[model samples]
Target chain A: MTESLQGARVVIGSIGDDIHVVGITILGHALRNAGAEVIQLGIQTPVEEFVATAVAEDADAVFVSSSNGHAAIFCDGVRGLMAAAGADDVLLYVGGNLANTAAADWSEVEARFLAMGFDRAYPSRTQPAQAISDLVADLAQRRSASNG
Target chain B: MADNVTNERLTDDAFHAQRETIFREQLGRAPYDLDEALAFSLENAKRGTVAAVLQKAKATGVAAVVPRAGVASWEGQRALMQMLDEAGAAYLPITIDSLTRELQFAEAERRLASSTTEVSALNGYPIVAHGIEANRRLIQSFDKPVIVRANAVDLRITAETGLASGGTAFVSGPMYATLEYSKNTPLSEGISKWQYIFRLMGIYSEAGVPMADDAVGFSQSGTCSVPALMHVGVILDALIMASQGVKHIMLYSMLQGNIAQDVASCLAVEQLATEYLHKLGLDDVSTYVASSDWNGAFPERRPDAYGLIAANVFAAAIARAPLNYVKTIDEGIGVPTAESNADSIRVTRYLMNLIGRQAHAWRTPEIEFELHLNLIQARAILDAIIDLGDGDPVVGSIKGIGTGILDIPFSPNIHVKGNVLPIRDASGAVRFLDHGALPIPAEALEMERERLSHRSADPSALGYQDVVDDLQFLELDTFDPATGTEVKA
Candidate 1:
């Protein structure tokens, strides 16, 4: 277990109409404090902007957050956008209060997001900082291995 | 699997131990069994019965309302609106989602604009999206105050959105840091996230805007040692964290099967928690009674009319809580019908207007009634707190206090009953404390209606099955032979 997040380029932002930001901000601060080069995309960013920012900055991870129950939509669009931008290999993380509609099977929800290429999916009320740090560290290790 | 189980247990114990540390460190005591603490509180309540929290809300000009968001179908929103309308309660309707694809927020806004219904837009749900400009624009589009829900996992978004939209308020939940606490995740990670959410809360509060911090969705269901106590602690911490500018923390208590041994048990927990908050110098914190009695009386069956009637009575018992925004009975059964919703309100209103006064002494320390209900629980939990030295109720962390047991357990359906992991280990021998009855289904309503409407007094009463058979045969034969074979499978 190495501290790979140090200087890792990570882009944190919210996608789609889901504008819940507290979780993301927390993640950003944690990542920054962990010594990551973070591009905080803020809330309600279009998919194109995220992809552009990631591509332009050559970021290691694309973290997306949403609080409204439609995490599936957020995950799907971000996955699609990442694919379109050929940044599909970037570590994709999705989280938020994604399912408050009917009582839902969140495991299935998590699987669905995973299938959409997210490395992880967080339930709403989940801690985002941990995920950000984990994603950064994992990506940094991978990057180091590939370059080393 | 066994290793995983053991590992999980270890994790949970660690979580509990950690929680106990926080409780002891902050509140300076060990956890008390919920029943005991609640008992203490009830004893105190008997000595003095305060006016219903709603009376205070009415008198104080402070409002505690839940922003209900409907599904894209808009039915939830509509139902919420109708309930508010009938209750004569003004509320905020915010559109929030964890998923925003397919939804054109602009289009939704446009449609919302067209409707004659009164609705003010807030950031809506999770508020987690990268559309910074879009989110900002959405918030800016609404002239009314917008609430920004922030947590450790989402502080970056909060800061950005706060800067962009000038966040007027914030809603923070306490379960966030414990995401990994109950899970197999590393302990360090959970601690860091916990610290992170706290930091975010501080930021939002220090920013000078009011925050409606949530106490605990964690205590009743998750990794925390004493869910209820921890929830109370978190809320108290949140109030203190707010450092004065914070408007009102919404204290939420759902009637899970386990929180209160009965309805009185439920109310006892409520009263004790509320009193605890009051003691914490958080006089401004408002409470809302969203009794998740979604499970009617029967845990095994659908909505029971009797259970519903009982829930109304229970609601009346803890009227002393800061806010009582009771959920309609039809919630657990299915989507509540408009008539059912009205019936629920009428029943609750009737209870409030009728028996509520005579029941004023309902919180008396001792449980005179053999039956346990919300009020009894309220009294009992209060007693538990008193036993814990009657110290101020700590909000965020439930480390040592036994009153933590008083936390309202959420429906098992949301936690363990469904696909979600069970809160406790299966092998662990635990007391099967009868919390209370859960709700039944809406179909039961039809069955009851049929039983009542078509029943006969004689031995040859037209039973429901008999009526269904008659209807089936009639449909099969068709009223007219010309319509024969028209009934497809």
Candidate 2:
């Protein structure tokens, strides 16, 4: 497949009090392999930092990860921050254990993120390649819609 | 004075009574009978208790090889254990699944049942979710000492289930569990909970049931070079276990890729642990060194990873750790197959036997020098902790960690300052780039600084990128020590 994500810059990190860096690092490697320039903020990044970095870099998307099961609490104000920063057009993605309860429904988690202004929400077990492919498609769609 | 003494006695009595009540209530939640549990464990035990296995190792001068392996279903776990046992594993491990580790029994139960059809449904054997009878069946299926391995901070219930169901040992220590696994857990709370687990072990010991407690070691700190920091963690845990009257304690250390440093660290841990326990007035507590093969990041290539594993196992064998925890060749790839697990055990056992036979010829001046340096550095860290606690290592550990006096680099725990950073010296031994608030002695600090200064002229360049590079150093063909840059093959 072609490097569809060529020249695209994506900002990724673990949000809030979550300090899981391995998953983000792995994802960063995968994204880079898929030809996306990944700016990894490492772990325990606040929502505002992600927005600020995305705006500063004029990034294509903001990818967030959380493994401490407090994603909802940590990612609550991200959409608002983006809107206030006037960067609401940036595509936002989140994945990993998104709630404290292990048995929380995935559909509910996705809906919660959607309501919080995330463009897409992946499950903890979603493959990095799959996430990157979807992000590429979504970015293409957003670009076409904006041009239209 | 009499009134004050009476009031203090009343408070102590009340606290003990409440604690006893809580313990009873927790125990009552499950259908656990100590006698029945002991009978089940004894019947299922093929290689006797963990203590017996270690004793055998000591008497025979051969290290016991234990491989970490578990699957979701009882049958899968049994198959895995049977493979390792047949391959000559002296001890077996029943690693708990993430769900069971988090105390989510229902999910673990569902996954355990589903794992029968879909083998990949769960990552480990959920001992608690499977209940006592299933655990008994799994244990009875194997003839080796089976230890329950989990990141259990509050392991009272887990320990009860594990011991009652034929697990002779459980892997965890308060500081290691709290700081390594549970990022938000308070060290004090973790210690109190572990005290209950230790009390349970003491009860079993009193009843003539052999039990062992393995403290989580510097293995959790990854590749960062802090032998003293890791040794102090082991000693602190040993002291806690001794305080709870644990008879057998295993002070574990991981292979940090340097033979002299790893050997020195292991020897120092055993020496210091024994001395510290003796000083604490716990002369009956027996301690042994249990070395784990390379707990750091592994190379992606299977051949390279196997080579690294073999090297680490050789180091552990040469170190003469009574118990050696072996990791499979497929560690970097993901969960290893049962055959790979068995292969790892066989390889480690062969190497250990070779080393044991050549024990008399295995003396080196370099090892002696490293050992002396490790002992001094470890003693300095431990002495500082004791001073911090006002003669109590336990109290001092809590205060030391709380105030960043004893810091672990790259710890996920928010409470940990994480300001301490470790970088490798010219010879690839770990040394602190930034000591942070570690209360190490001035001489030890100077020695570490001097060692690092020899590696790089610009020590200020040692920061986040250095750690990232060091974590993946094994994967690179050649690593530039000065810049921490990797040249791919």
Candidate 3:
């Protein structure tokens, strides 16, 4: 079966202070092939810009990934801003090399993100396709609800 | 030619046997994937080999080490020089590219004069063979002996082109691994490239020279603790090898902070790593701080005190590993400009040359403890072998020799490490020395900003910026468990 995400408008970028772009680039390509309109904000992006762009562009979803283990700090203002902009309907996701077993617990990190109202929190070394599929399903549900 | 040299001056087999013993003694085993394509250099006499090569380089005046691969750090270069220095030898650091490119080498020198580390342009994949012929021409124009370092292919080119022109050619290491690790498809295809290139150059070697491969594979033991443990492993291996009779072993270790944010995390990791190496037997291992001062591309996280901690930790490494050499910082950044590069060299040079002039000082109690722990660990791991039939140091497997834990890579704030980094006027000293490249030319920096700007989804857009702002709040200081609000530092 073909992985056709043709009609999804996805806004992809790094949130907060992360400079890693390799994972984001690969994800963009995968999403694009699946038929999503992928907008890539390379690095060092502010959350205000991410939300505004998604709202103005009427994007179906906004995805941000951070490899630096500060995702707790990275995902903070983003959730609130999305709600303020009425883009709360947009599916937001985050991932990267955030925390290891040595320092912080991954479960606590996941809980913190859930509290902040993120739709999904991807653990480190996650499969890129899994993230895209979840975002696609969320967006599809939103589309059907809006039309109904 | 081989027969003439063998009958008159050197006998290859005897030399090989002696060198092999040294290798076994120093590395605790025969070289892995040992190929006749490269000949191994004996331990203590490696400096003799370097001195001889440098002297030959001086005599030839047009000597060039092509695609000067393998050893990429200034410490790599310095380790070679220290070997030469031990033998009372000297070689010029003149490079044709330094003159031709807009790269800042003058600043690198100034940085070297101070005590800061400078990044060498030889970071990833060795120096590319960008301008070999012209460099050769430049060397030829000089009236002094020049040693050109080249891999097997470059050696062939140098030989074929200068064939009756008369110049000494000593093949530097890089060929074997280069052929082994190319990103090209089909292993045979890579081999074919090496084969064809060597064929064109007309220089083929059944045996190649061996060089030390120093690496600190990634680990996730929180902070620089992972590197610290790995350093212990390297030192133990070297000491065991030395006990076996190897006279020379080049050790290189860098604090891998590519995934860390803030200079502190980097420094913490480096400090632990340096301490471990010092405790081990490698007193002369060179230290290079690969400082990016930011955790892998993310900003919500503050800059860890990598630079601050690295300077202190490296100082400790120098004090501990008197035998190990230390390069400057800026190793992970762009090719260090001249000012930065010089500061690196000068910093290491002063540490080794002046203050380090006195007999090497090692923390005795620590080394004793470290050695004791290493022995205990080694015995436990090798109990299986010791339990088996006859056992010998020479026969110890690489795994049986050390703790044998290949470090695990993890994503976490490396700064959570507990080491205290000392503060010094490191950058201030480098600045006073006036040895840093002017932050990339304004125009060039601007051009890059513009390039990345093209990838920007929103400039003044608030939605994206808001998400980013919230993330920053999470790390503004610390998350207060009581209130859940960001704490101020």
Candidate 4:
């Protein structure tokens, strides 16, 4: 927790037809460097595939990246599918151009994803540093509480 | 995993034998007419051809501005080419549709037939679905020389269709198609696909039609394209294509924000490509340089977008590259209107006019340093790749990328190591933060690290945050002078 991600098993992918890979690619690289085990499903992945991979890898967390502005539709059944797969306890993170058009306010977009059952939803262009730092702190707190 | 036809240049009989099947079966319904298509290209080469336009641009000391645009219907694409031509575009581009790019001809036909909107359901013009006749009509509608633009592992169908349709030039190289577009295609397959395409191009050239080609095996490499990595790709792609008998070639340099590095990269592509081609005894092949405008985020504000586009044009003009691939102001939003695309050309033409009088090359100390760095870094990668292939670039590319010696940052290709990390230094020059297993000399790698450590915010260390910021660097509205980055982020 103090030095890095503490070997968190993470699964990441671009949902639907979104091919913009810069954001999650850097995040994956940073996660791997931070001592997390990452399985990258790559662009154009379906929600069911993400859930299946998460279950197969027994991933502690799953990060969904979308950049063609179709995340709202593409991520519709993500959490429900995870719950169906009995991986409801697994952490979910979502980010990248979340709307078709640039939003007047990004918070509404974040709230929309949050309501869909994501633990954390970052707005467009959020730095991997911030994402990693938040994940490390959150995982550490969660693990300690369960131990007690 | 190895095939008998692996990576090496295709023999004459091998190419024709494959072509009989490709032309006979690849096109859905359009009869692949070799004699007629070759004759069409030969006629089009008289006044409007990419190679001829570049030659004119070089002679006139102005960069020929070419913009990106395409639609599903013939009517829309014709309008785009004509408008850009009237606005002073030296050449035109027909971007192929995604389905056609992937060889999904039937799906592309469905989309083209069902598309009700003025804009295309498919992202680009479907070369295969439209077939040879419709594509020829679209190309012959405009006077400007046209270039076929499509990126994928398999381009046999698209390449043949475009050339046969009378387009004078073709875009993309093998290594580029695999890394940027393909998710599962092996690098060897990429090389073989291109060999087939190049052999087809060579046949056309021999049949009295001159064709232009380039090795654009990778895109802008986005934010941190260390000028050298791109230069090497162009050089290597050029080498492989020329081996197939392609005579006229162009080198594409991505215009990263830094003028010094940008100009140096423009110089390096010509320098390195010429040197490598000459070294390999392919001296008959002619080379021209083209620099593409910034391939990153454009400003949302209209005025700011115009300013950014103008600045990019200025750099390309200063370098006097034979061809300058321009970006539109409407890029930050959605699809660019014909007016906006024309407006970008007007801005580029004005700058070209203003700077066209002076032909003196800019040779500042910083530019010279970047040029030197580019040569060394590229040579390191190229030499390593060639050595990996036992003196064959085709074989070398596959082996080098597989081993991480030729690692490209941000590549989604499974074959690529993607271990190299590039980040902007304090002065805004791209430096390798993590060089991975690249066989570059230790001293040069250390130099990159030392340069990055000069960041004012934290001189001794860097983190993923810096890289994140660097990736978002173009999108930032303003820079915080103290942190050497944006205050907004």
Best by DockQ: 4
Residue range B244-275, candidate 2, lDDT tens digits: 76789888887877777777777778888888
- Candidate 4 structure quality by residue, lDDT tens digits, B1-489: 234334456787777677776656765344466788787778877756888888887887777888877777787778768888889888898887656776768877887886543645656788888878888777877777799987777789888889988887898787677776566678777778788888788888888777898667454554557888877778878998898878888888887677778778888888888888987788999888877877776666678777777666666666777777878776665456678889888887888767654525555788887888878888888888888878788777877777888778777677788887777877677777777888777667766666666774443466556766677665555553764655431
Q: lDDT of each model, Cα atoms only?
A: 0.42, 0.74, 0.36, 0.76
Using lDDT as the measure, the top candidate is 4
Computed on C-alpha atoms, the DockQ of candidate 2 is 0.10
Question: How large an RMSD does model 1 have?
Answer: 18.9
The segments of candidate 4 whose C-alpha lies over 4 angstroms from its true place after superposition are A1-11, A15-19, A27-39, A44-48, A51-148, B1-8, B20-31, B356-362, B446-450, B456-460, B480-489
TM-score of chain B of each: 0.45, 0.90, 0.34, 0.93
Q: Tens digits of per-residue lDDT for model 1 on A21-98?
A: 435655776677677899987666677888899999998888887654445444567777777888877887777655
TM-score for chain A as predicted in candidate 2: 0.95
Docking class of 4: incorrect
Clashes of 1: 120
Q: lDDT tens string, model 3, B1-489?
A: 211110011234543454455335533445322232122212212333333443343344322121121222334444333333332222223221210111223432332333212323222111212223333343344333323332221222222222112122222111121211111122222222222222221221222221222222222111232223333333333333222222223232332321111122223333443454444343543333222111222212113222432443343333332222222233222222333333434443344334323424533443333333323332332333223213422122222212222111211212112121111011111000110111123443343234223433321222322322222221233344654553222
Identify the superior model by TM-score, candidate 3 or candidate 4: 4
Between candidates 1 and 3, the TM-score winner: 1
